[model samples]
Target chain A: MSREHQKYRAPDALDHTRELLGKLAREVSVSDWHLVIEVRPDDLPEVALRLRDDETLSCKYISCIIGVDYVDWMEALYLLRSQEHAIPVRLRVRLDRERPEIPSVTYIWSGANWHEREAYDFFGIRFIGHPDLRRILTREDYDTHPMKKDAWPHRVRRTEWRWEDIERPKRLPGETDRRDRS
Target chain B: MSTVESKNDAVNPGSPVNQDGPAKPSFHLEEMILNMGPQHPSTHGVLRLVLHLDGELVVSVEPVLGYLHRGFEKLAESRTYLQYMAMISRLDYLSGFFMEWGYVRSIEALMGVRAPKRAEYIRVIIGELNRIMSHHVAIGDFMLNLGAVTPFFWVFRDREDAMDLVEMVTGQRMMYNYLRVGGVRWDLPDEFEAGCRKFIKEFPAKIDEYEELISDNEIFISRTLGMGIIKPYEALDYGISGPNARASGIDWDLRREVGYSVYPEFDFDVPLGQHGDCFDRYKCRIEEMRQSVRIIEQALDSICGGPVNIKLPPMIRPPAGEAYRAVETPRGEFGVYIVSNGGLRPWRLKLRDPTFSAISMIPKLTAGNKIADLVAIVGSLDLLMGGVDR
Candidate 1:
């Protein structure tokens, strides 16, 4: 709650963010405040817990977690928040394509459970220590995770059988129905 | 707070293993793994929850997602900046206005552009109306989940009325992509004011109907009153927002705290709850709908006549920077984080679904409750799987 640049409290949120970040982590250069934490894969969950629990850094809320598939590795970016201080923290965890696994922070904040699961199911990142880590929003029998950049499904043409043509009656009960054959 | 410290007795304390094998020595009870959904109506979507059940009590819930993954973010990377606006509506199908508003606000923040005063007024009016509509459906769905059939019909009946009002203005019922980069797509039609006025005047009484029907019903209270209780500290820690946070006695609303657009111009109250529980969450929503009606009335009275949209170039390429915009959706705080590359397409676009935190709160809320209570807790969260899975 360090008040410095309260003018952009509502409007011009970016400037407000820059000033707040400057106040929080004094060592972080103002220029590099946007991309704050460059964390290793294994260290991410621990860092996240500290951010959520430590009184000095109670960033208890994870606003969003996104996964981007780059050519070399998959990048998982988390946007977190501290409503009391009105500050936002950005954390990144990049995993190589060969072995994409990271610990789950769902234990720290229960809200991260489904989000982490979604990231794992779609991006193919194995969430180590995730309780009941299973596919959620996908079809039960669907073979592939649709969002994975590397995987592509074989598309097939849809077939529809019309009932009118297939069940054409041979004889009508009364007068002969108009029969037109071409 | 420390009570939740999980014991290794329930699960193996050894290193996490990915292989399918016999139960380890540390594993005490043999838990049955069950797939909750793919087609089950309770799940609300194709969402499949892999559950480890110790009889009826759930030991763990593993959520599998991507059934409704339209790859919106991936698709946005290829599309032009302005074109991506249309796609935001599809991310959270339930509350499209918030999704659109969040994206536009982010773009405006990055580009340093502001909507006109009149446009801002309209934005508040329409956004609040959208909130009301969302709550209607949410309450209805919640009631349905609680095994209450009458409330769902009654809630949706009013929700349709709100949808009719939206359709008249935008010409689209569900996904009204009426929000533009700097403002709205069009001005409110002549009948729009009258329609809104009619709704605002009658909405309070209709809410009374909801109270008499559901709120006063002893069965509803027994199902919800004390179930899924959350404290303010826990609510904040878990990143719960909107009605969910308010139910926990947290008196914070982005509409008031953040005060984006012309929200400050209108006089309205941010509802708070004394106890955070399923009942409080339910009451918070009903009260919010009332507040929305009040806000709409104020905005309409102060609504000035002018161009609804701001003029901007067809191709939008903001300077290289990042912008994050948060809006109070019915579920919670809906945020959009966008990274611009000073090009037609954005470097990265991420949507923060409010339901994500609410979903995470599920285990906490339902851990000790009966199986029936779990259904009530899920409904109380009022999640949209589209946004969660997107």
Candidate 2:
């Protein structure tokens, strides 16, 4: 990095956030230079409110909410940014594979309402208190949350798309094991 | 219930409208439910707005989406990194360059690579040109929504010039998938710089003409000045970004704040609005077009000769990691988030479209406005469903 080309930012931006975050975050680390905080599903709302209302880490802009299904576990990622700091702060919440749910942060940031609904629509991760937690993109009656790993065709598996080896493709939770997917 | 009563049924139970029955024909005692386009002319795409109306005033608006949902996020899980680049531009066809740029930036970051200096400059040139083209549609469509037809035709006349320059370099007018992972597909064509210089030199005069046509016109000002006001806090609270957030006097622009790519090297200014109304949003786009012109001039002057792309194998696998990289498109900050599991395809790829945030805030912003103003407000916000549905 060149000296004159780079703009000024806090040297230990992550530490400042760590101190402010206090005990709310179960784990704090860096990913791609962005501060990532792992919090329990229940602590999500409190952690989000602190991030928004805090002075140094005023992460007001809600960039995106991402949901991932890893077969064994599901992940929800909230990417936020502070206009002042120019540093992105990510909140990672892991949930049970059978019932992936977390407290909603829509009250903290109104923009999260749609993002949370989108997460619910795509990954079947329930945002516990979202006012209108319905499908945002897909049709409301769409049977499956298509982003889940097991939402793949009954012939194709998640990690390995070896259609020949498996007699039955993995089915989503609460779904019948019938191989009707043609 | 009879035909008259069914037509005037209560849309919201507590909105000073009687739910028991339609009481009077003098002024309808029940709220009327108005369903606007999955086909209306003003709505830019197949966006459906279910507006709860009491006479001409809107009680509440429930925007029904997914009419054009093509499953962009779900489709990414099956495509390889290189295969996905071709589809990113389709997210927002108006600002396709920025979409490709955002996608390539994240992949390059995941692989710890940077495009050559020449490639970066070329990217900036094409990107700003794309920005001008997008703002053209915004201003044209905004005027069209306001019942003005001349500006729409005028912007289309000028947009063709910018498209020609883009076509020369990228070979496609709309879906120019020119940006590659490491750098770009190729170096700038010999005629691109000269043609770009000619366009920038004359572009300012064309902006002045658009200003002359609509800036001080009585009808335009009366309709837009204080309509659809988004407070500064509301802009932040709703996650609005790009010109819509900047128009609200939020004082944030990713190009200046984050200063990614080669934006910092050039000297330019970001315009801010005072009232955060429809006028400010329109004014912000006009001023942004000027600023984009300035960026093109500076980039053209400073561009240096170098190898355009660094050759890597056709099939590339970035190390398992997650990265979020956003670029300031004309609408707002268009971001691409990628999570790889050391595999051929992304485990999760989320396209954070700025228009989605803009659309979500519509129900809050449009309440209590006249149906006419609702048209003005939606048009002024410059809604594009391509990216939002994705």
**Which run of 10 residues does model 2 chain B get worst, by summed lDDT?**
B6-15
Q: Residues A41-160, candidate 1: write the lDDT tens digits.
A: 777766777667656446776776777676577888777766665555667778887778888887787667667767776677788998867765555566775555555634321124
User: Model 1: runs farther than 4 Å from truth?
Assistant: A1-50, A53-57, A68-76, A92-107, A117-182, B1-35, B50-60
lDDT of each: 0.76, 0.88
List where candidate 2 sits over 4 angstroms from the true fold: A2-11, A155-182, B1-26
lDDT of 2 by residue, A38-151 (tens): 999998988998899888888888988999888899999998887776667889999998989899999999999999999999999998888889998899788998999877
Q: For residues B229-273, write the lDDT of model 2, one tens digit per residue.
A: 999988988899999989999888878877787888989999999
Give the top-scoring candidate (TM-score): 2
Q: Extract clashing residue pairs from model 1.
A: A135-B64, A136-B48, A136-B64, A136-B65, A137-B64, A137-B65, A137-B67
Tens digit of per-residue lDDT, candidate 1, span B89-159: 88788789889998998898899888887888887887888898889888988898888889889988888
TM-score of chain A, model 1? 0.65
True contacts kept of each: 0.53, 0.70
